[model samples]
Target: MRRNPERRAALVDAAIEVLARDGARGLTFRAVDAEAGVPAGTASNYFAKRDELFTQAGGRIYERLQPDATTLAGTREGPRDAARVTELLREIVGRISAFRTGYLALLELRLEATRRPELRDVLTERVRADVEANVAHHLESGLPGDATSVRLLYLALNWLIVERLTLPGVFSEEDVRRLVADAVERVLPAVTRPDGPGPS
Candidate 1:
């Protein structure tokens, strides 16, 4: 197969859009080529197999949906106190909210993975790596939690993201903010609280 990094990247992005708009069932090479405004069969040339296209699309969605540097710097700075952790969680929610399409595409990919064992393995590893990275980041930042805590937080945030994106008005913005605050407090209790022992 030919190797054109930029073109392949464009195809992946287009695939993400297609996945978000049309779901996995509608994701075809022809659809991707149309979405990318490239000649027919362009996506097929870049990704000969459907699974390959889906894998690349999943990776591309993660790349496009990552939090910005400002948010990362805030998380890295200072102690990971309850308030700080809440703020960080809020920032993450904001970023995910901003890139709702990419996250939606990722969610679609997760569902699609169930039907294909090879794709399932690839997606599982990708998600596992992401969780591991979050665990490491929490450790480096002195976040008030272990890998288990990080994993819980990851699952909670992902659920919230899906709910907010897919269900729209199910939860107001303030409701989500409060949910994040409560989640952080529960998962990562403050190191020291005047009242002693954090919320249960």
Candidate 2:
């Protein structure tokens, strides 16, 4: 296998696009090569097996989807209340929806995982770690939610993302945003105020 990190990353990204468009059955070395506009067999050189490519693509998609430092820092700047949580959920939807191909490809990886135990294990671990990280973040940031609330939000918001990416017409953009706020309200305790700015 080749040792060029950039080339390997490019191949994995191309594989993500192919998986999103064609699913696991259609992801071939030649297909990835064409998608990447590299020489034939280039992907095969980097990934010895199709399963290896699938695993790399799965991780690569999440890497591309993760928020940058600015986005993370912004989450901590505002009030730590239910409304702030709602805005965070909205940001989650918007961020994931913006990377349509990556999210769609992730869905494909989930389906493929059903038949491939190796792939399933990797995905399971990565997703579990992600959930734990969210829980930690919620707790540390003084967000108006417990661990369960964060987990519930994670579940609801992910399905919302799926609907937005796969069947966008089902919900208008405004409706999706509303649903995010609704989901937050459902899982989080109401943070009511006396109709004025919070006291010092």
Candidate 3:
């Protein structure tokens, strides 16, 4: 019999919640079944292997990241106005404070996947897509050369936000916002440097 897609998705979301709240060691099929409000066999039926379940769980986590990522994605089609870039930068910083653990869980899953090649491959694809989307957005907006620098900016900003969450009283969300915005401003000019004088 075909399983309901919604129900299957619910189970996958539940697994991510469990993984985030309890960590990988604490995650179990039983807990996911409980969280999803379904029979234990139901989750098993949808995901016959633990790796398969974790894979779906990782996908759900990435889906949660997309909305804010799309804020960055929007700037790709054209040059981002200053206000738009600031707003996007702040939103990205805010997501770090709001979903710190979820982000950390994603990091943990990435590390765990190193020993598990299949899971690693899945996550690598998602990460590549995310970075590419952002990179494309930056490039389309007339940002030139130094793809590595732009990619590094993306990586550094994300790590900086994540680092703030791991500390207490070291920085506030506002501080992160300012820092990220400053970093973006420094990087933006280089990417959008003039090839020649053009109409502003």
- Highest TM-score: give the candidate number: 2
TM-score of each: 0.91, 0.94, 0.79
Give every collision pair in model 1: none
What lDDT tens digits, residue by residue, belong to model 1 across residues 1-200? Answer: 66999999998999988999999998999999999999998888888798898898888877777667786777788755677777878888888878877888888898988888877887888888888988889878876767788899899998998999999789999999999988976776644366645422
lDDT (tens digit, per residue) of candidate 2 on 87-192? 8889888998899989998999999999999999888988998899989988888877678888899999899899889998999999998998888766754443
Task: Mark the regions of model 3 whose C-alpha exceeds 4 Å error after superposition.
Answer: 68-84, 143-146, 189-200
Clash list (residue pairs), candidate 2: none
lDDT of 3 by residue, 136-178 (tens): 7655676443456468677877778667766646877677778
Location of the lowest summed lDDT over 10 successive residues in candidate 2: 191-200
Worst 10 residues of 3 by lDDT: 191-200
Cα error, residue 117 of model 3, in Å, equals: 0.7
All candidates in order of lDDT, best leading: 2, 1, 3
Model 2, residue 72: displacement in angstroms? 0.9
lDDT of each: 0.83, 0.87, 0.70
